[model samples]
Target: MKVSVLVITYNHSRFIAQAIESVLMQKVNFEYEIVVGEDCSTDDTRKILIDYQQKYADKIRLLLPEKNLGMHRNFVNTLQACCGEYVAILEGDDYWIAEDKLQKQVDFLDKNLEFTICFHNVIIFHEDNQYQPYLFLHNQPPVSYIEDLLIRNFISTPSVMYRAGLVDNIPNWFYEQGMGDWIFHILNAQYGKIGYIDKVMSAYRIHAEGVWSSKNRDWQLNKTIKMLDTVKSNLDGQYEEIIDRAIQFYSQHLLKLNSIHQGTTSKFTTNLPKHLELKDINFIVFPDWNQEEEHLYQNLYCLVRLLLTHPENNRIALFIDTTKISEEDANLCISSILSNLISEEQLEKNKNINVFLVGKLDQIQWRTLTSFLKARIVLDSENSDALLTSGTEIIPAYTVNQLIEFGLIFIGSAKPYKLNIGCGNVRFDGWINIDIEQNYKTVDLVCDARQKLPFDDNSCELIYNEHFLEHLTLKEGLFFLKECYRILKPEGILRIAMPSLEYVVQKYMSDDWRNQEWLKYPEYQFIKTRAEMLNISMRWWGHQWLYDTEELYRRLTESGYINIQEFAWGKSNTPELRNRETRVDSILICESQVLK
Candidate 1:
């Protein structure tokens, strides 16, 4: 056999058949075999495996252990049974989607003999929750070395395909490893370079019974400690520093756990030092500063110093002379200074600490400040009591609002402009992901897509919205589409992926519709007749409007879009677009361009 697909199972009865069927459906010119280790399953997984083995006798080799060998032993024993040049791994709960998945990987490895391993992306689906399924290896680099594996395990189990015969004998440490896949990738990387394909061709299911699923923070830390220990042993002090840092990183989690367990206890709440006074920075300068504002700015110096006792205060007062600097120029200066102080990496690391913009505020400038610095606009007088309680700082700046806006412009221009509207935890790498909900880490901007986009006209080069348009009413969707057109550049690309009404209707009316396993989805479980099912499919999942191909095309055209083209699932004329996972039969993907 040219390739051997290894599947290790224990009690994955419900999902085992799907995994086997996925392997059987591989479209490849070269011969391949499926090696399954049942490991004496208590569920019907063994029966399902036996049925598959009996049916595809010539292509399948079964390993039925007399007793449970656990995951590691079963994996090693099953891997030993593989007789192919290349070995692919897929746990019993995960399944491949693309028929050409094996073909693609084998072709890459066959051409590039220097590469010992290849991997693609896989969608991670939560079996019991409403969490949206997302790609696992979406942001990983295309190539990795042994040192890369030492840093972190970018490889997932189902997405991996490595050269066989690399491991003559499984080490005793392999059985003791916390995550088998991590060690497996490290072993393969020792031989040759690792390759990556960007396509999402497989899926990993996360359920309660899975070993790593539903793990607490402490349990996850323990697993990390184990993996780091195993890795440190293999590497000859090459990554000792990072490993030490990682150990320390996990060690710090103990303090975080304690803090969470106990109530909100400020480290600086008791007898704290007063905030520094701003001698030269006395008055707040804005477009309009009345007598009320004058009174506020006169006492700003002392008031800010008194509020610096609390530990939660991250407020900084700016003392910029707006009389000498224009609003636009002030924005740039403030942005440059803030960019120097807080890097993107730093912002990501310190998420809980709010940077308060405590200075002069222009109507337009304050909005820009909030957008770029992600700072809260605060007045020393308005928040006198709260600032004293939270330990606010009064730093000096010349112009507040204008400086903030300038910084936003500078940062926004520096980054490649791609927008993901209504991005619900499915983040696209190098894109400004926006959603209605805010998780700070994943979402860059939190705004309703139905409203005007929080971007300048003709600013974005590419915009993507998956299954988001259907959640808006017909009028709302049209307005949203128009907004998309407005934000996209003259030659910008817009891709909309949503449920296809026509496909749902056709599938509902088909004779084999009831026989379809997908119809057993919770949304359609109670519905009996074809019409009822179709109606529910259209209305459920917070859907406000559904569209067919023709309707979608019409909407795009009405929104001043041109060069509208239809695309199949996982197929797009635009490069870097087709690699995204698709919903297949139930979804429609259409692309439109602003051709001026």
Candidate 2:
């Protein structure tokens, strides 16, 4: 195999030798030469390149630009000057991970002439080697995506080795101010399927100037717009996916960064676009806004903030200017998204908990009827200001050094109240005995409730829960309600089960159980169903929303029942239920006063 290596440098005087040496030490059975482009570096970079040229004149082609030609131009000119059957790229600060990196790639492409570009994963590291980005330990994918690249960019530039004459000429846009070799990869992948060698090929140095290491706080993003624009400006529609992926790559990167810096609350804002893709949310309600001038994004931001603050896994009805997208088109988009979001295997309508999302104010009548009927309780998931007023409170009467037990912990188990929540030891006894993985506990029957009879309304009269719902997704929550309604008989009841919104707002606003370690357990799949069922009203999140004793009573009456009663535990300690002679926050149920 005959190959040419291109090493582009800006101000990499100190690290250039190490990069060059890696190429020199390659054990390839081929004729190869090194081409170094010292882009006008206002440092000792050029001098070092010429000095290396004098020593290894036969093996090296040093191009010293009279003045800095910038990275894009320098790379293009450097490649044009090199004459080799196959060309491999390397940057200044990075070095080969294995001397065989090139030979393996070259041999594969040489034999399979059908191949144009082949790349591999790089072990990224800091200058000090203190923190390595690529965890050979974690072991992620070796080589990946090029398609829908407007969606992602996994192949690094320095990791590529393409057959000569892959393109007629270097695209002019690469020399543009903000463009780089990624653009070239996009162009290359547009023509051929990307090939991979599942081994570390290079040590990608990640310093401040590293493409992905630096931090950018803006997480809500769309990359397709920029790519489409770029494609329109330079390459024509042929590179549409490339541009689109660039946008998605940036947006996804921002999402990850926000998760790192902003916490779970920010996810709602970041994932709104993703949620809008949900197929279940029909008739999206935008309470107020002119979507005509990017105001929709602003409105969404506000609503997402509200949803994050409360436990009610509810949606805010932000108003969008109907002129932007017709109701039919908008509904189609949201419904399709919801459909894609929830799989048939995991979703069961009219079972467990189901949330009905309405879009326009015209739908408020239906909402009111549904709310009056299904809303055993409805507090804005975001309205934490008046949270946990469930008329339950308790004191730390005594101290103990033991871990809390599930059965004995609930305070409402006394005379005035009884609740039927939590996996009954009687029914799930088999589950309790099962190990975390040996049984595949939850993913099978234990995890799902299909054959589990779901719930029986009067089974237990109240619910006592805490930090659990965020595990199962929104679809799972809907199923929980279906079970809730099915289980309840005429006057049967449910006590609130879960962490208080006030508690979450003040101390756990950004808390979510999805990312917890428990999710790795076999029971987590089943337990997560419980987590999704728990929600906060004001924040419109995991717990859904907080409930009041009276609202609970009202919902029963509205749902074709009679003789209802409720109590409020406003602004009081939770353990000691306000009216209950115990130390807990809970609600009681009686015959519904009104019958629907």
Candidate 3:
């Protein structure tokens, strides 16, 4: 045989068929066979492999082990079975995108006898995420030597094609190494230089079940350290410095394992805008002001002194000139102070701290101001006189400071709260899990999401729901959004994950379903015809309404939200909301703010 594709699989029932079909689809002039080593998978992987072998009886061979042989043993046994001029490695979860992938590599290897291995670029796509696909070793040079292979395993497994007879009996250490692909590449590199094709011909799938993909950085680092140690012993300390440097870098990475902020003490320094800066203290009153304007500056200075004394206290001084300044100007100034002076984190923390010093304000003014700003009022007192001494009356204003302190009865303390609505089985840390079904003990509140939430108005800091919005009808969805807006505090975030109408429509209409590369996967074959695909798009999983970006944006805007931003699947500004389990290509994420 000219080429033998060595495919190693274990419990990869969902992906094995695609791997086999990719080989079957290859446009090779010479004969090639696929050698799949089924390591006695507990899943339907073995059955799937057997079916593929029957379908491609002449071209496919299976090493069906009675018991689990483990990854290292299975890989070694699989490699030994390939009796071809050249062999390519493709893990069950990975697939070749290019039909001429093998032909191109074989031609290159046939001409370049000095090269021990031939590899090309591979697209590394996350199985559970819609993140933009990235090329593996995108910047690596076209030609790589043994020294390059030693430093990094730049060649992805699916992209590699090496001389078949180059490797006979796999080393004992290879069985013990955490990353078998690294050792395999290193072994081939020892014979001659490694060749690289610049074009992307394959895709490497990263999912929860992946060997190195699922492992934490600490585990991966430890594995790397062990592999490097083994390499050092095998090579007689030839590449000591490079290996040592890598070990050192990874060892330091262990210190950063607990990346979550435990006790972050970020100091806040408020920088006033250039326009707000006192150029002679006359800017506040603007034009050539008389007595009232002059006195206003004196009161402002006193207020500034008081604020300086208690900088930590949440105090807001609103100097409103009903006659002099327009409402737009007043809004701009307030917006500037809040936006420039306060950070989002700080704002969330101090949302309930009501300490406002209002000047020249009526009931209408107070209503307008309070509607926008949720802060306490600072009343005139003996301390206020102490600063002003010869004060000519601090602008005729009414202070509801005492009333707010005594009358306003809050249902709960202003402790920031997060809510997960329609939370079927999933639970978020430090969040109230609400669901219609109370099957799980994690569910804190049980209620239908279509109705009003049990949460108090302007109480929740964040509300997130994945794959829940589409279940509601247009009217119900609008009501749900309104409810979310009502419960969320000013500047509270509402993150929603829903099925993408655009993605589904495109998938149904496109001829991508016809291609072998696309048809090889089961994810695309759920619906047979275009009508079924379209019907499934709307009716699947008891969906009432499906929305694209534009529709979703309109609904959110109508429900009184601002700062709306769309995120790719499994992506959000909020780290806690970035859950891969709730992600897919058909899933679209959106987040907006209940701007006060």
Candidate 4:
């Protein structure tokens, strides 16, 4: 199949070199034609494309738009101009990192007749082109079903290769609204499967200039809301689920845009997402300075109010240099009324709303030196009280252990010798709450469960912990479990929610490992380090045990814990919790009893 590489640009003279170089570098079995639509760039961006066309006439075709067609209109027009069976797009600001990005995509499309579109994971680089692991780390999996695509767009324009025929039926109204790309894919998926390559094959540059830049986030999000409505309206009975989910996502994104637009001062008004998670950054009341040029100080004052004291804005993370802040400054932020993000009214109004202050990133040295030293940013935030109280109670509530529905009743312990080691923050509403830390107000016992079971044999109905067991020393933890056997009813069960190591590696460590970069430099070979195959095995999250759901079954069964069934869930925090004390949120239910 003849693949048409549609390259569009407004003014990307500096980055075009890398973009063109990538196309020329492809070593594929089939030939691909490169057609570039230069949108009459006032700068030398057009001149660069002209030179590339002249040099590679056989491989490259350059189309000069008489005047600027703008971003959305430019790409849709390029489709009509380019003549090829297959279509792939590469915007000027972003470029392919992989030489085989096109070839691999084409090959996948060629072999998989059912699949019409293909995309791979992209690595997001800084404007200076620094290798940022955080972007890749957060990037979701490449291969997704139609259901996954509906939640949000995974394929960036630069990373996608689609069938040319699919676009012929698409109208200009989709593009005119500025969110043509999303509609393009949703339409294609209806015809067949969409393939994804699980590698970082493209470089996505994020800065002030691009259309989807953080500054233009409002335009993109607002446009996205419009597109979602269009998709929701067109949903046939079969596509209803995706469309419904899209509506929910549309509302969430709209609310996020609202939060971002109102200068981060306002509490989230739109009641959507059941559990809204904001990791760590505090900048509310940031005005749309780009839109309001005439009202500069008004925007500036709004930004200052947002920075200093903005009511209703809940900062999930505040990335500040703690060295520049004092106890007085801290008190202003903590006690400020405007900093009143999740009020009592807001909590009853919505569900599980969280705000935080994350203070670490590349080279933007946090004003405070000690900001990087905290063990767990999520647990250390002003809203930690809220996380513990997320589904249980409303705010002004500080204790995690004081919930009425802490009703995760375990029927029995696996073995009389089996010990319940580390119980994160999940306390039994009726049982003893034990931990070595004096800090947690609900801790019933201050001794480490890894060393011994403080209780006698055959006591606990069940040995249960949410996402907490993986953090203990394996040798000590194993011994502790053996002791739990000494205190369990014969018909007992060990209900544990340990970390799925595979899930963690894929989520944080695999292709990009930037989990811990605040205190030290990001060490490369990221996946292996996070897996802790070498010394990572020694102490991970201050833990000594690693298990997927499979190993948990083997370890407990070997220790004489009968009816030992293991359940796994995902947890995302620096402390990396797995069992009790931590709130485990998953829909999967596991019920078992110790062999009577």
- C-alpha RMSD of each candidate structure in angstroms: 14.4, 21.3, 18.8, 18.9
Candidate 1 wrong stretches, greater than 4 Å? 216-218, 242-596
Ranking by TM-score: 1, 3, 4, 2
Mark the regions of model 3 whose C-alpha exceeds 4 Å error after superposition. Answer: 129-132, 259-596
Residue 526 local lDDT, model 4? 38
Candidate 2 weakest ten by summed lDDT: 390-399
lDDT of 1 by residue, 97-214 (tens): 8899999999999999999999998877778633545568656888889777765677888989999999787778888876888888887788999999998788888888888766
Which of the two, 2 or 4, has more lDDT?
4
User: Per-residue CA lDDT of candidate 3, range 332-435, in tens?
Assistant: 54444444334632445344222222344433232222222222223332233221221212211223332222211221233356788888767764566778
Which candidate has the highest lDDT of all? 1
For each candidate in the order shown, give its overall lDDT on alpha carbons.
Answer: 0.67, 0.47, 0.67, 0.54
Question: Candidate 4, after superposition: displacement of residue 4 in Å?
Answer: 0.9
Cα distance off (Å), candidate 2, residue 129: 4.8
Supply candidate 2's per-residue lDDT for 208: 66
TM-score of 1: 0.52
Q: If ranked by lDDT, best first, what sequence of candidates would result?
A: 1, 3, 4, 2
Question: Model 2: per-residue lDDT, tens digit, 1-596?
Answer: 28899899877777888888888889988789999888888788788888888999989998887887777788888888778888899989877757888899988887766557887777655654332133232233443455544444566766889777677676565555344666777666656666777776677776765533442335113233344356546765655544433443344334333333445434334323322222111112222222343444433333333322322223222222233345786555445533433453344333222223333222212222221111112212211211112110110111111101211121112222233233322122111111111121111112243223323334433332222332234455445444544545434443333324443233333455344432443222334333342332233322343434444444444444444443343222333323321223222322222111
True lDDT of residue 498, candidate 2? 36
Number of clashing residue pairs in every model? 15, 114, 4, 76
Deviation of model 1 at 6, angstroms = 0.7
Q: Between 2 and 4, whose TM-score is larger?
A: 4
lDDT by residue (182-301, candidate 4, tens digit) is 778887877777787777677777766776664554466567766766676666566654554455444433443344245542333222132223432322121222333335333332
